[model samples]
Target chain A: MFDISFENAKLFKDCVDAIVNLINEGEFEISSEGITLRAMDPSQIAMVDFKMPKKACSSYKVEGDVKIGVNFEDLSRVMGRARPEESLNLKLKDSRLEMTFKGKFTRRFNLPLLDIGGTVPKEPKIEFDANIKLNASVLKDSLKDASLVSSHVVLSIDKNSFVIEATGDRGDVLIETKKEETVVIAHECTNNAKAMFPLEYLNDILKGADSSTVITLYLKTDAPLKVEYPVGQAEIVYYLAPRIENV
Target chain B: MFDISFENAKLFKDCVDAIVNLINEGEFEISSEGITLRAMDPSQIAMVDFKMPKKACSSYKVEGDVKIGVNFEDLSRVMGRARPEESLNLKLKDSRLEMTFKGKFTRRFNLPLLDIGGTVPKEPKIEFDANIKLNASVLKDSLKDASLVSSHVVLSIDKNSFVIEATGDRGDVLIETKKEETVVIAHECTNNAKAMFPLEYLNDILKGADSSTVITLYLKTDAPLKVEYPVGQAEIVYYLAPRIENV
Candidate 1:
C-alpha cells in the first residue's frame, strides 16, 4: 500500500502531460528515494525519463519499491479534474488508482490499472559536444514558429549562438539566440553540432515547460537530442531520435 | 468605406462567441449609433440578437447605414488571433473583410464576405409573466450541472424560487435559488411558469456571462425562453425555442 499527497497537483499533472502524447502505458517505480518512470515510445522514435523527489510531496509513504502500471491517457484525464489551488491525494487500493482533489467538494476519480507487461526501457548512453541552458519559452516559441512552417526542425548550436530553423514548401522560420541574449543562461560547446528531429515530439515535451522555467539541451551531430527541464521538485528529460536521411 | 476600432477586441470576441454555436453566418449593421446583428440558426430552433452601442467602441464610423455579411466562424477565428491587450481595427475593403490586431506585431486576416442571400429574420414578440434578474453565474452553473445529467433542462419559476432540473437514465440534477438568496436581484412572478429548452444552446449563450454580470430571464408556460445579458456597452439576447411534449 502506498499513499502520497501533494501541495498542488500541477507538477504531477504536467508530468503526465509530458508522456501522454507519445506513450500509452508505462510503469511508475515508487521507492524510498522518490518516483521514477522511464519509457520509450512504441515507434522507437523517442524516450522519456521522469523523476520526482519524495521531498516534493507534502506527505509521502511507501512500504517497499513498488512498480505500478498506468495508462497515461486515463491518468491525464483524471489529473485534469484537479483545481488550481486544490491539494491532491493519491491512494492505491485493490488494484485501482484512486485520486481525490481536496476542494470545496471532495471530488474523486477511480481509474483501472493497466498491465504494462514489460519493463522500462534502458536509457541510451551517448556523448554530446554541445550543452546549453536557456529559458524554456525561447525553445517553446521557436518550436511553435517552426511548426507553422514544417513538421521537423533542425536544432543547431555553434560557438556564437543557438539556432532553430524550419523550411517548408510555402515558408520558413528561423530563430537564433546568441550567448549575449538574456534568454540564454549558459552555453558550452566543444564543436559545432546540428541535428534534425520531429517537431511533434519536441512540441509535446514542451507542454509541461513554462516560460520562466529553465531548460537544458544536450546535442551532438546526427545523434539523439536530449531536452531537460524541472517542474517543481521533479526533473523531466526527453530524448528525441534525430531524423536521419534515407530513413 | 467603413472603419471602426476597439481599444480591446474582447467585446467583439465575446459577441462572436455568443452566436457562433447557433448561427454560422449573419449581417452586421453598422450605424452612427453602433453595431447590431440579428440572425436565426439554420435549424430554426434558436435566434440570436446582438447589439453594441457606440460607447463600446474606441472609435466608430459609418458613411451611411451599411450592412456587411460575415461568416461568424471565420470572424471568431480571426478575433482569437488577437492578443489579450491588442487593439482591434476592422475595415471593409471592396468585398473583403480585413481585420487587424495591433500588438507587438500587427497581425491581419483577410476573409471574403459571404452572400447571405436573405434578410434577417423578424424578431418574435411574446408576453411573459415572469421577468427575473439574477447573478449570471447561478444560471450558468445550473446549466453546467444539468448538462452532466441530460441534454435538456426544465426551467421553472414560482412565488418562492427559480429552479433548474434535469433527469436522465443515470441520475438527475436540481439547482434552486430562492428569493432569500442574494443571487436573485429583482424577481417578479405573477404566476408559475415552466419551459424545457435544449441545454447545449443555453450553455453556449452563457459562455460570455461572468459571475458578476446580471442575466435577465423572460419566461412563460411552454414557450420559448429568452435570455439577456450585457457585455461592455453591448446587450445580447438569445431566444431558444422550447421543446413541446406533443409537438
Candidate 2:
C-alpha cells in the first residue's frame, strides 16, 4: 500500500506542471526516502530530473520501492482543478490512482495507471566553467525579447555581465544583465562561456518556474545548459542541449 | 484641430475594447459635447451605440464638429500598449490620428484614418414589459453557464425572479437570481416576458462591463433587447434582435 498527502496541493501540481511541457508520460519512482522522476523528451534534446523529498508531504507511507507510469497530460488536467486553499491526498488502488481534494467540498478522481516500458536515461556528467543565479523573470523576459527577432538566442557570460542576444531579418534584440544588478543574485566565472540554444525549449523549461523563483544556471562553452530551481520543498533540474551553428 | 487627454488610459482603452469585438471599423462624431459612435455589426443583427461625454476627459478641445473614421483593430492595438499609470493624449494630424502615452516614458503611434463609407443605422423603437437592474457579473456568469449546454438561451423575467435557462443534447443549465438576492438591485414587471437570444452576441455585449458595474436590461415578448451600462463617465447601449423560435 502507498499513500501520500499534502497540506497544499500547489506543490504537487506545480511539480507536474514543470515537466508536462517536455513530456507527455513519465515514470515516478516512489521509495521510503522520497519520489524522483528522470525522463528525456521525445525529441531527445532535453532531459528533466525531478525530486520531491518525503519531508515535503504532510504524510507519506510506502510498503516497498515501486515505479508507476502516468500520463502527464491527464495528470495535469486533474491538477488544474486544485484550488490554492485545498489539501490533496493520493492513494494507489489496484490498477488506479485515487486523488481526493479536501476543503469546503470533497472531490475525487480516479486515473488508470499505465504499464510503461523503457529504461531511464542516465544524467550526463559535465564540468561547468561558470554559474549564475538570477531571478526567473529576468530569464523569462529575455527569452521573450529574443524570440521577437530569432528562433534561437545566444547566452553568454563574462566577468562583467550575462547577455542574451538574437538577430534576424527584422531586427536584433539584446538583453544584458550586469553583475551589479540586483536581479543577478550571484555570479561567478572561471572562463567566459557562450552557447546558442533553441528559444522554444528554453521557454518550455522555464514555464514551471515562478517569476520570483531564484534559478541557478550552469554554463559551459558548446555544452548542455544545466538549470536548477526549487518548487516548495521539491527540487527540479533540467539539461538542454545546445544548438551548433554551421558557418 | 482636435485634442483630448485622459488622466488614466484605462477608461479609453476599455471603451475601445467594448466595441472592438462587435465592429471592425466605425466613424466617430466629435463635437463640443463629446464623442459618439453608432455602428452595426457585419451581420446587421446587433447595433452598438457608444457615447463618451466631455466630462469623462481630463481636457477636451475642438475647433468644430468633425467626423473621423478609424479602424477599431488598429486603435485597439495602440490602446493595448497603454499602461495603467500612463496618461493618454490624442490629436488629429492631417489624415492621421496621433496617440501619445505619457508616463515614465513617452511613446507615440500614428494611425491613418480610413474612409468608412457606411451610413449609421437608426436605433429601433420597441415597447418592453420588464426592466431589471442587476450586477454585471450575474449576467456574465449566467451567459457562460448557458453556453456550456446550448448556443441559445432563454431569458425570462417575472415578479419573483430573473431566469436564464439553456438545454442541449449534453444537458441543461439554469441560473436563477431571485428578487431578494443582492445580485438583483431592482426588478419591475407588468407582464411576464421571455425571449430567446444567441449566446455569442450576448457574451460580446457584456464583455465591456466590469463585474462591479450595474446593468439595466429591457425585455419584451419578441422584440429587440436593450442593455445599458457605464464605463467611467461614458454610457454604452446595445440593441440585439431576439431569435424567433418556430413551433
lDDT of each: 0.83, 0.88
Judged by DockQ cut-offs, the docking class of candidate 1 is incorrect
What TM-score does chain A reach in every model?
0.94, 0.98
Model 1's i-RMS, to one decimal, reads 7.5
Off by over 4 Å in 2: A1-247
lDDT: worst 10-residue window of model 2 chain A: A167-176
User: By DockQ, who's the top model here?
Assistant: 2
RMSD of 2: 8.9
TM-score against native, each model:
0.57, 0.55
Q: What is the model-wide C-alpha lDDT for candidate 1?
A: 0.83
Q: Please list all clashing residue pairs in model 2, or write none if there are none.
A: none
DockQ of 1: 0.03
Pairs in steric clash, model 1: none
Predicted complex 2: DockQ: 0.04
lDDT of 1 by residue, B1-247 (tens): 6789999988788778777877889999899888999999888888889999988889878899988888787667656555678798888876777677665434445667877768778888988878789888777877889988899999898988888999999799998988778888988899899999998888777776878899999999998899898877789998889988884
